[model samples]
Target: MTLGEKICRLRKARGLSQGDLADTLGVSRQSVSKWETDSSVPDLDKLVALSRRFGVTLDELVCGEGDAEKEHEPEPLPAAQPQGRQVLGGVLLAVGLLGLLLFTLLWGLEGLLLGLMFLLPFLLCGVLCLKVRRRLGLWCAWAVYLPQQVYWTMATGITWRLVLTTPHFTREMNYFRLFIGWVMLAALVALTVATARSFSGLRKEPTPKMVGVTAVLWAAALLIWRLRALFFGLFADETGLIQLPGLVTGLLQGACAAGQTAALAAAITLTLALLRGRQKQTPG
Candidate 1:
């Protein structure tokens, strides 16, 4: 291959766009583009920088010499965590679950579910460690899901308020409640199924079908949630009048849930677009 051709290939292999390469080498993006298109050659210093950055020797970079060691390199292993990491993850998750159970026991098995909202951060870490085999996009979903969950839990705990059992109940109100409940439940189930399929034993990543189902369910939930605010509004005062702050918080939570689902779907789509699986990068 020509010098410029080699630069182009290496740049692509490293997932570097022209702009990315340019920024790294302190040059204009146009220069990088030119080099890639063989319109111009990088200088000696620029070549050396490229060589180091791309993990290629000067001989390989300049003369297109194949690295004998790299030619016979092993194929990437499945994207699985190490046994020790898995054990550590299991321990962390066990601690969180047991702590939650302890809170359940201490809080009378009913009232203090929210009291252990303090464990949110630790549980989040545990989840990350335990599901380390999951695609990168899944974590974005978790990020979106956690904060609203924390807020909702803490708010309910502080006010000692339950979302259900209204004195001013109507048939429409009941239907609305059921709809929201079902949609949220279904969305959660879909997401869980998707997550379960992300493991190496079942699948390397979630199927597109699962992602589509999840996105649709979450979107439906979001739409129903907004409709609730439009018809009944989210907040209530002592006299059952609409309250602005409550409505705002309610809408914010709904939006957050939907956004989280969208982020997950988008992230996974990007990952799927790649030609290869998520593997530990060899020193190529």
Candidate 2:
């Protein structure tokens, strides 16, 4: 079939008169008739518009020989932006690895340098995750840092006091591990809430009081955990390096302690984000 014949067939199948299709496209009915009669072709822009309006690919609409399999198939979106994000993520990860090597060489046998090596990548990944808007970028950032979180959660949570107090523990007394885990958990919760709101198409404004209360809870809990650890450190054996458990065990323990706070804060923050997203979706 010719392009003209295909257009006529599709238009009739959609139950649209030439005048109706032309009206939908903001063009003259005579132009539609002319195209159906093989008088002239639509401009490129018009062709795209027609393709969209008729739910057909540009190929299917412009040429009668469009494949049946390709007719309703949506074209794959361009990956230019995602490719750039991946490159950036790769560079950041490499820098982190380089930092680790340097730290290891400079501070041999003193796990402090190795600790810094572990931290740099997580910090970099967190920054990139927050800065990049694309899902691919966010996930890439997470992938780089996720292992660290798992390691910390397993190390610290299984025996919170061990990772928090030991000289061989993360140099920051488990603080870095806690902080990174919380950040990642928060992002996950926010993403979840945003997705839920998008699908439901509902918006709800979170009160400032709610945010303030959550902050207060977070601060108070953090302060108390730190103080408790300090007092415990004073009484415990100070010389030996405690063997901390793996990532799974540690995170479970951490979740039992301060992990809940981070998770809760994440849920609240995500809910607020979802509310805002839904509001934007609404017509002004």
Candidate 3:
């Protein structure tokens, strides 16, 4: 191909219009148009900038026989067997050590069920990030379900307190809280099961809109929870359980937060799907 043809070809392949290329190289759009159409040529300085921007040698860009095809090919694989297992072992050991350090440092937080309330979700998210398969998300979601189960298991202490404090209503309210906890557990399980078969389909690919929307939804949910907790705290009885109405509202609020977080993650994956679809539409 001629010089102009080569410039046009590389520019299009890089998904840049004449204006985009010109802007990158500090030249006018008309100059790029002239170069592509063979009406004019760039000087040595601009030519060098063009070579760097297009990722081609001057010979390839100008003389048109500079082995551009070979330059664009993927690098050759190494001859030796890779140390994949050793690397993976090192990573795991490092993570284990880090966890030990954190556990030791946060001594005061030990044995608090509310501690798992914070740790479990982040651990689940980290696991979800590391694995590509939907099984990763499913397993993480399932593990967090344990916390909801154990919330009631430890509720025995609270149950005792309620019984001693208010014997008449103790049984009913304790059962009610347990029932709400069970419902949350069931919701996580159902969502996990539904997403498990389709998790691999939701690979994390970065995009502006997806990140923005997920961030906004998360912020909004957090704000709503904060307002509910702050403003509604005044209505709580001496036990601070907010009585029946507040207790039910708090339970529903927590369920909504869980659903919102899940929905945010799902929305991100759906945005990635849409982006991939657009990519498939573009021709080489």
Candidate 4:
């Protein structure tokens, strides 16, 4: 089908007449009729508005449904993902990888955790830059880093004693670290899912349902985290437990969970995207 046919079909599917669409798009009824007859195309902004108003993706709105599969662009990388952000992400990835490599070569095995602690920001920023279309690299960078800092602090809780005149171990910080660790973990997971969804060729708008769903997911993640003691106690021994503090263990758990969630979300995203591609190829 031509673009005009697709637009007319979509407009009718949404129960809109030429005048209705024209009014919605701030154009004359004649202009809408011209677009429907393929005399002329809507401008870019109108095209975007039409897609939004019809609740269809721009890809579906613009691309002919009956076109040959291979005729479509491969990857959609250049158009979907901007070049400058990809380059910036690549640079950050290089910096992070080289930084970790240099640290490892100089300090050998002892500095691995230290390397992770310090290098997470750049590495995360790089990954987010490459993955997300939005410029959320900085927010994504901090969401994980701030919690890691708390992790690092508790890992060296020896500092708490070192700074104080009278050194004493306390449970005060345990709750704080555990709760805040999960908060950041939930935020990171939500961001990971959002980032995965971006590959669907549509933007996600925030809604009350979204907020409520997020809150529920956060609760689930927190519940899983709350049982970390039992989970760790089963597999971990005293010698091993002594070496890595509870806060550090919590952070590691969060990291592993985040990685797994990212992988799963990405897998689902790839599957949906492939399905959409197949739909676009299939003739109606």
lDDT leader: 4
Error of 3 at 193 (Å): 50
Q: Candidate 1's residue-wise lDDT over 1-284, tens digit each?
A: 67888788777665567866765665667888888788998888888988888887888888878783552343344323345556775776677678777777877644244434545545665666666543535663555455544454334321111233445556865555545444444555566556644532221223476566556655554464456446554366678786665534554554444454444544444344221223322244
* Predicted model with the maximum TM-score: 4
The TM-score ranking, best first, is 4, 1, 2, 3
CA shift of 162, model 1, Å: 22
List lDDT for all candidates, in order: 0.56, 0.57, 0.56, 0.61
Q: Please rank every candidate by lDDT, starting with the best.
A: 4, 2, 3, 1
lDDT of 2 by residue, 45-76 (tens): 77898899777888877765456654434434
181: Cα error in model 3, Å: 48
**Candidate 1: stretches off by over 4 Å:** 1-65, 71-84, 133-145, 152-225, 231-284
Q: Model 3: which residue pairs collide?
A: none
Per-residue error for 278 in candidate 1, Å, reads 25
* lDDT tens digits by residue: candidate 3, 1-284: 77788788888776568866765664557888999899998889878988888778888788876676754554343112124433443564456445645765776445333445445555544544444222454655655654443444343322111222443555646666555645654565476456633533333234576568756765653464466567557777787765555334544555545444455445544555546545644696
Q: In angstroms, how far off is 26's CA in candidate 2?
A: 35
Q: Ten consecutive residues with minimal summed lDDT in candidate 1? A: 154-163
